[model samples]
Target chain A: MSEFGSNSENGGRVLSFEREEKCHSAGCLELVVQGKATHYHGPRNVDSLLRAMGENSLYANVRINGDVLDRRDFENVSIKTDDTIDILYFMGGGACST
Target chain B: MFDLTDEEILRYSRHIILSEVGGTGQQKLKEARVLVVGAGGLGSPVLLYLAAAGVGRIGVIEDDVVDVTNLQRQVIHATADVDKPKVHSASETMKQINPLIEVDVYHERLTRDNIFPLLENYDIVVDGVDNFPTRYLINDACVMKKKFLVEGGILRFMGLIMSINGGETACYRCVFEEPPPPGTVPSCAEAGILGAVAGVVGTLQATEVLKIITGVGEPLFNRLLQFDAEGLRFHEVNARRNPKCPVCGENPTITELIEYAYTCETQAPGSS
Candidate 1:
């Protein structure tokens, strides 16, 4: 398993299951993750998505679809497929107010 | 209600015609007092747009003289202004843009001792500074004074903006926590910014200021807006006020202004 709990052994099972459900929902929601199109299997919460995006810092804010996800929901709120996840780092290069 | 002369009506006809910024908004703009911190890249567009919008009292604090290289992005300074005090050049341009508005010039650098007194008189503070030390200083000061601040920064082809309404919104420290270790990040001079990128960010800062002054639109409070000019992508990220924030938190650790060590190597002669 990778640090973020991606199990190599379960990869095949996850893909097979996802493929089987692909016909039902057209690949189970495509995520525009971090400014890129991504395909994720099953429903993932905001925290997992953030970890997948290599965001280890808690100073980040996650947006689901078009709404901002509260910090309390990062671990519990499920993000469906086709949802857009924007993980923005709020630091660096702020010479003024930004 | 402000008594608008016939000339004033014609001068701001476009703004006066807009339903959002009618005569009432124009009056608010005329009564607003805004302070812009820098006169370089980001400060240039911010000062120009705010002046053109006819902000009544605009205070600019800049200690540097105009250099030939600053002309690329510091549009407020002209070719003839080279070597002239940037504050003078900026004030002259602002007056030329709108003779009705008053421009106050502070030909000195902002420091811990002077920041509070200088900022107390302004309704809103617009930060266009180019260094991290001053950025943090301004943030802490604004937080303590309970003032609204419009913050922006630009480097290369990317820019970021945020607005903080005292302790109510997410202050700069709430996001960055603390400035990066000195020498860890490159300065604008070292990284070399695209001149036009500064214009994009500074113009947006001015827009935020106008929104704050007139209450026309929802400012970027508790949110961060980042733009990548290269790909033409914009992202708005929600930010939360940290209860553990050193300066603006419930159990705040920082009660006074603390000046961070300056690491910029290209200092003017005699500057400490």
Candidate 2:
């Protein structure tokens, strides 16, 4: 049911997004990449990693080492072995008026 | 310099008793002015705590009317106040908590033209807003104005809080860069936030604000504090100031406020 149903595993770890009902995708629930955890070395390209984790939807913002990965570069972007990747998103519902 | 009355001394005795926040620190609080940009969930706790801490002048802006649904987490409002403007309703509660402090209420929306003049009077600004556009707007404004800003947000069981000393520290834009395109991220209404999650983040924002006012402790500057209520754990992200950040970077690009046309709840293009 995931948009990216690739077979290769992702290289970086994931954060609170796995099984996070609000998260965009599934299949990467077991990987914990918050702060400094373990790193999977399968795919370096962000697109490939996201595809492998099934979180490849363009909607989710990919953050690598603190910078927001440009949407145009997701396909070819490379993640270094020491890089930290966080799949982040947000909600709009505080005072609601701002 | 404003002096704390005998009654205020008794009321904030616990705070004044602390070596870090003695009479001197309490006096600083009395002279500090803070602006809170929202009256909903996160704003609720920020308002309550700041008011209770005896912040001299507290200004709140919101063009929203309270709704029944808000009762779940917007603790500052009651069922009876559902039809009332959020600012008025929240201000009343704040006054009841402490009649000594002044609560300035603005029942208007914050716009690019008005943000500067509005923020000019306050020493610190707190972002308890819900939407991303407003979040980025507040950050950009504070960074440009060189005012301290305490930013917090909640979605589901996750919450993020960070403090920015205007251009000196890592701003919201420095960490998140730009608001994710609308429809890409879910809204609290759709994503479902735990009511207490807002409390957790809002209270933290209030703490950061007080810390800024009294200069007592280290604020969350250059650090993004992430909270997971479900797991009851906290995560800290190093929010370093980036030279390439469009807003606070060396050669800034976002010279003016930018408002996204759509809210977060907007459905992505054609997706069902």
Candidate 3:
């Protein structure tokens, strides 16, 4: 019973079956390829994912499987093959007209 | 006084046709007073819709002038508006959209000493600002004063929006409590934002405002909506009122407003 309700975790990414084994090198089929945004390597741990994506990790807010993960938890959280990660950072762009 | 004229009736005929927002809802829009802070990216679409929708009286506050860089994402200001004060450019454009609605402009900075008086006349507040300090300030002020606020943020392809009813719903601080300790805060660089991203989030904020004024549909309320444009997906998270929230919690530690200091820009590539 976490704060987040019954909504689909990992955003709306269709879960492509559960991972039976921890497959590291052979490439994970369900990787949410954030291409062009960063030189993304197949990230296993949160730090590697951030490093691969070239994200600063300072103010970047991370959420895995849709649950909000604190900055302190970044080092501890690992990525499974089926996991979906969303990193958000808030900025000041008032009047933010477009 | 909020009655619609023949022209006003004709103008909003489309809105009047919707069963959920007939003549009564249009009238609610006419009588509503909304104060929007920042005339930049997010404020652009919000001002356009609220004015076009015939929101009775709209107040816009801005201390920045229109720049060459802002013309791309800030749709309300024209290329000719480059050197002009943003409040003037925004108000002029809003008036052009709908002369029926009254627009009040404040060409000054919002500060701790002046925010209360600035918020005195408006019923609802909209946060279209681009910095972290002001966002936190606006959130805390609205929470302490018990005002209805529609919060929006966008960067690159990411967009976040939430509606706050002060102490009743979850405030911004309730979910993301870290405002950074003043001097300890480092400079945050801006990543280029897709111009359309602002439009997407700002339009949603405007929709929430219209919904709130008319009492139609579910107004985002305690739900945080995140839009990832790359995936074109919308994710929602339910947030209950945190009983342990510092400002709005049962115990309530923050009785007074606190102003945070930030170095350089807060985050993302946004112009205000």
Candidate 4:
């Protein structure tokens, strides 16, 4: 609704999930998960469970389980709305900085 | 009158066989002009393929010389060619690959002052440059000149190829926003790359060049093709033109070229 997708908010919890719940793009990810307070997700919030698993940025594909969740797939994806989101890591390295 | 002889027809028969590329594509390639910056790892295969693919006019801009270490991945230059100017060595090899193609060699580095005038003549620009400064410079120049740019980069075993059709597609800065500070990500010399990775990525770039000229299937405009050689997988990332990009934005901020020097104060391990 807010320029990303679907209807306006649709009024529900916006629980955000990334492998370790971190932000890889240096941008912020906000989740209204179940309409509680909007959970601010980024590199600064490193203690959360979603981020503890290193789910910040994925290479191959990321699947989310919930229908209400807003997922931004950076690369390739085959999202399943009915199940928990899965992250498939590819190119397990960084790009050249020179 | 770029007539295809019997041998020439046979050599390019596979290309002419495709409805997308046919005889018309062959002719386009013969008339196409390309400007290649940096004759290093990425440029090597790109130059080789573009030459062999029959791009009529190919220009190479490189200031560096061939070093012993560069031979590991810069395949165009031979061991005997080491210590020679890369533009000279690369031109020799490209001509050998296809004497029919014209090779314009720039013996000096591509700087802000020189890049504009140097690039104005070519139909397309291929960025095989290793540094961010040149990368950004080439992109901005292409956008300013309304030229197509085939950009590629390699780090370790992974690489990506994307073509910027200037006003038509998202520029490099649209996706990356800004380059990481120098040395934040290690160079191939520091990280070590799989030599063949250049061949893979550079070949893809050459394919893009051919596609652009031939008007073939799905050019990589507005999309980034990512390759992971170790995993043997390829993926395409959708890129959006940033309204905020300094070069091609609605209100561009970078009105001119700015030189940024990023070199280690201390000598690297294999520093000459």
Candidate 5:
């Protein structure tokens, strides 16, 4: 996920093409950009978007499509056809406080 | 009991004629309490229409004294009222408009300590306020108390309106997420607003309040309506409640109130 690749996860578009450019002090996430093809862009999409983002993780827990994935779920989640995903930024934990 | 005499009904004949707002609605107007924050550009119309619509107990909150420049857009105040306390002048005008209604004036700045208590007494809260800090504060208070909020804002030629039913509808935080860092946006005093633009937004806010009170018409919940007077166009975008929203999300983060100091030191350097 270093640069643009014809990964089936991104339809035909490029995925994870840049280097992390420090976003904040917290840290960054390695993203894999799933361009036009798969239209799947998430925290795990691009390495640079992730690197730039640092440790500022988007999702404390998430599920690709319908599969529930928590903090440990980011690496194994596979991209499929017509699956829309959002790399929502979650601070502290996934649960709401107020 | 605020009785409506035949003369009063006659005076409000048009409003009373609507099936949605007959005597019962009129009576609700008499009983309902609304607190309008800010007495400036947007506040002027909100106050004017809410008062005219016969909202029973209307409270106008403002600490700003009237200024000569405000007259161009703040219709509630007159040229002679310049330098007069806005709360005093606005309340005076409301009483003149409808002596039957109760007009409580708060000639004090809206601060965090007072926001919660002040909002608690009102049935509906109208955000005719300009700055983001007060707007966010108002939103938080309303959500926490489950009060209906009618919010309207105008910048230059554009404006936005949202009806927050607290937990029932998308709040102001649901859309923008955060305010534009400070000094990113200019105020009316600096950027300049077409007087009518504020009137339009304020009037729309007043209408939303009436509908919420009278339970009539489609309220602008879950939607952000924008009006661009210069382009003569109106646009509406659907706003969904962010499941992760800090204030109104499914998993809320902001359990208590947090105050963000909002003021602009730059004098229209970035006006408009």
Candidate 6:
């Protein structure tokens, strides 16, 4: 499995569609990513959203509308406009030991 | 019922005036026992505030001593305390703030053998340690003992705070599983943190402890609050308890506390 895939055996999978739909249209979906709202253009998935946020690793968990996104769905799961995505960066140093 | 004397009543009048923390809540604060794990930058504000707020018993565990350099952020210590043990200096300040409260000083580092005994009597554990190994040890110990822990971390201009109610809430392990590889993350010594940032994070930690003691506001349970002092932005992210968390999860793997190898630079003779 790729590094971006779930490490557990119970990992879920996202099936791909034959024809992709564009996320940018007259009625394009808007997403609140990391507290900032942005217009989402073409079939936005977790991977695309993460990329747009300059995040490359799947080590962090992505929450959509208060639910954790399954790692397997990163590439296939479609994100709708108005959805709130919160990316938790758990590794940043916060402990104050000097 | 915990009775407050005339002096006590006047001392904590501000807290008692709050509807959430009336006379009853003030009494609760007087009965709460909180153990703070560090006496440096973060521990300074935590100990001072807990003392000022009338936490009945506050135990501070710190093995280092005050240094002239520490005065930049370890506000609880003064130039006169430069050579004194951190816990001693901190406890002295705490008492000066509120002689009505009791301050216990432990001039020792937190290790696997002493952690449980040190924390067994306290109602809550506040993490102000600046290293990964000790941080992980505290998290695991808190989970094992089912003690509430208010954890905070600060680096450069960023800080994060979370509250863990034993194994019930999302634990430190539930989110990060393990500490990052040594050398991958910069220590405060290497990265340099703004002195005020420590106050921000440590003060938040003290607030969480007070909230836990009096049951006043919503604690940071099951949530991680991150703040960027430079950008002046705050964000809260949802964190769920992981059943696979080695320390708090069912069918657990970490049955006992295991001390991770310490790789940080050795502290100067009296530097925290």
Better of 2 and 3 by TM-score: 2
Fnat measured on candidate 6: 0.12
Candidate no. 4 TM-score: 0.74
The CA-based lDDT of model 3 is what? 0.73
Q: Kindly list the per-residue Cα lDDT of model 4 for residues B94-129, writing each as its tens digit.
A: 989888889998887678899889877798999887
Give the least accurate 10-residue stretch of model 1 chain B, judged by summed lDDT. Answer: B263-272
Instruction: Give the alpha-carbon lDDT of every model.
Output: 0.74, 0.76, 0.73, 0.67, 0.66, 0.76
Q: In model 4, what lDDT does residue B170 have?
A: 88
True contacts kept of each: 0.08, 0.28, 0.19, 0.10, 0.00, 0.12
Model 2 clashing residue pairs (backbone):
A11-A40, A94-B130
Q: Report the interface RMSD that candidate 4 achieves against the true structure, in angstroms.
A: 10.9
lDDT of 2 by residue, A8-90 (tens): 23221243333322223333322334553433434557777677665534535567877767766887887655567676545
Cα lDDT of model 6 by residue, B1-272, tens digit: 55999999999999989999999999999989999988988898998899999999999888897878889999999999988998888888888889999888889888989998888789899998887778888999998899999998876677889999987899988777776545556667766879998999899999999999999879999999877665566887778898877888887899989887766447321122
Could you tell me how far off, in angstroms, the CA of residue A90 lies in candidate 2 after the best superposition? 3.1
User: What does TM-score give for chain A of every model?
Assistant: 0.57, 0.54, 0.54, 0.25, 0.33, 0.57
User: Model 1's CAPRI class?
Assistant: incorrect
Please tell me what DockQ candidate 6 reaches.
0.12
Query: Least lDDT summed over 10 consecutive residues: which range in candidate 2 chain B?
Result: B263-272
On DockQ, the candidate that comes out on top is 2
Off by over 4 Å in 4: A1-98, B1-7, B264-272
Stretches of model 6 off by over 4 angstroms after superposition: A1-31, A39-85, A90-98, B265-272
All candidates in order of lDDT, best leading? 6, 2, 1, 3, 4, 5
Candidate topping TM-score: 2
Residue-by-residue lDDT tens digits, candidate 1, B1-272 = 66777888999999999999999999999999998988888888999999999899999987889999888888888999999999899899989989999999999888899999998789898888777677888999999999999988776566789999987899988766777545544556555677788888889999999989888989999988887666566766667787878899899998999877666545321110
Q: Kindly list the per-residue Cα lDDT of model 5 for residues B93-168, writing each as its tens digit.
A: 8888878788888887777799888887898998877666677778888888889998787766667788989877
Backbone clash count for every predicted candidate, in the order shown? 8, 2, 19, 19, 23, 8
